[model samples]
Target chain A: MSSSSSGNVGIVIVSHSSKIAEGAADMVRQMVGNAVPLAWTGGDTDGGLGTNVAGILEAIEAAWSTAGVAILVDLGGAETNSEMAVEMLAEDRRARVVVCNAPVVEGAVIAATESSGGSSLAAVKRSAEEFYA
Target chain B: MHNVNASRAANAFAPLTASAVLVNAVGLHARPSVKLTQCAKGFAAKIEFALAPDGPWTDAKSPVKVMRVKAPQGATLHFRVAGPDGKAALAAVLALVHDGFGEA
Candidate 1:
């Protein structure tokens, strides 16, 4: 976790397939800005049926350095992958990382774009609450 | 068909807030439309969607109401739910749209 205060909101959405991940991420970028960083994993690139942790880790590092990081993942193995990522982070870094359960792929971007001036965690949480409640 | 214009219907709920994207390549056409309507049926919130004049506000739970709205591909719909769990319900609708009716 780099200590830079970019105040930039970063979101990474993981899916079993890169297409799904890219689609959701692109949809969000369309709503927000074209510069949102995305870390795509899984599918043929990783040659697996689930998300690739290495790719996700790289994304996390990028997001953390730019601003805070929010993660949205598809259910099932994707969820497990996100959880594992959170566990791997240091205590302080873990605080900056939020694994959102909202319709994530869609919700995270909506929340991130909508947040504007709040912490990345707040935006992701809002998206999750909206999805949950 | 059932007295949508009735005063009682007007009094049935209040305004709510939510966001959703149009799923289904055809976008708000058939089966999924019914699914959305069905999901909203049990709620008393007065759901309304906003897009363009072509896509006017409609009840979230009514198949007929949704059918009349004509939300198309990639259209983003903002909903106001003015009843119980209205916010939550609206979020769900947003998810459905974002998911492209789970087709994505």
Candidate 2:
């Protein structure tokens, strides 16, 4: 509903704790300040330390943009669920989603900044991957 | 703030050098590093940062490399700038560095 988050590359954060996912998103919002679209799903739909495929899918949908969406997960399980969400998307949407290989907090922040600059899918993912460097 | 590698104009006369002391309690950690990297990307120049004035400069435009420095508080980061908009890029990095990244 905000102009700041519209028309930019989007980001989805997946974490085992709603606090973490939301916190990471908030931190990014602080740094980038709504310059990029951001969405997140934490824990299970039941509010446990698990990821929900449907929730992940919905989060991705919330952050969707033609510029592309980058997903960052807190752990392996979150990663798996995120992948499933991508698979569950319509073929057209699936093509625009990428699960990044960066840590959740750092990756989300880095990716959001890159997205705010209106970068492409590959470039945002590349910046996230550079977390290890 | 010492100059390790002397500035040489990559073109006719636009090379620049700047320095800033890391003042945050943890040095150049996640938030600060990310802020610096984002600032570095705004220019087309070839900019680098290093702990030493004379050796081992890393690309300013790379978040990974900037994070790799693990520059702690009290460490002074020196910058080398060359190419188009090099002077402007150097000034921005130096200012951001001095800003302490809004950290304690």
Candidate 3:
């Protein structure tokens, strides 16, 4: 979604650990009640990690097709992995990849839940950046 | 105590050994698992866990394995360390769990 209109914002949070990822997601779910799209990549290398590059891309395309806005959060290894994945994408898709500045748990949950008003990926990242600042 | 952060807790892998303490507290399930995994980040080691008192230990860094032990409040879990800096990491995490995260 563009910044000028009421578009959906997809939010991602990466934590240094899987528990933090799930905790962050749980916090947001408690706050926002599942209205927002959430994805997590914790520090685990298991198959249950859910959203990786393929999953993230699929989420992005889904958001773009459905909501036209995508926001991603990567904590710890998730950050490096997600970034690497984004780098492998085309310019158009890569443009949508925005890493957040918020702490893995609190900041991420807060920013993602509060995201509205046609928030852009940059805006979400800005919120995350300011979250840490 | 030092504030726990993502970067500082990385790659500090440890192993799951015998535990004499059970993590006690309400709703205190996943937080420790998360902490353990996060603490394992950035270090050049691996982390795994096992239930204390005759439970099998699994990958400490794995959220699923950590949760499987279900080290609920008042439940003791064991930890082991087998990599670089494993001793220090094990000490730190064990202390955290032993203290019930300062809530016990």
lDDT of 3 by residue, A1-133 (tens): 1232225466665554567666877876654344456665555446455345655554445444233333445445566666766677678767666666556665554445335333456555565465445
On DockQ, the candidate that comes out on top is: 2
* Deviating ranges (above 4 Å) for candidate 3: A1-6, A47-76, B1-104
Q: Return the clash pairs for model 2, or none.
A: B4-B53, B4-B54
Q: What is the fnat value (0 to 1) for candidate 3?
A: 0.00
Candidate 1 residue lDDT tens string, B1-104? 23355345545656545566675688886445545654565455666676753334675654444655677887777776666566777777777677776664
Which lDDT tens digits does candidate 2 get at residues B1-104? 34335344444445577788998788988778778877877777778888998648887767667878899999999888887788788888888878788776
Docking class of 1: incorrect
iRMSD per model? 12.5, 2.1, 12.9
Supply the DockQ value of model 1.
0.04
Off by over 4 Å in 2: A1-7, B1-14
Off by over 4 Å in 1: A1-5, A35-37, A44-46, A65-67, A116-120, B1-104
> Residues A1-133, candidate 2, lDDT per residue (tens digit)?
1445566789999999999999999999887667787899999878889899988988887898888899999888899999988988889888889999999998998888777656788989998888765
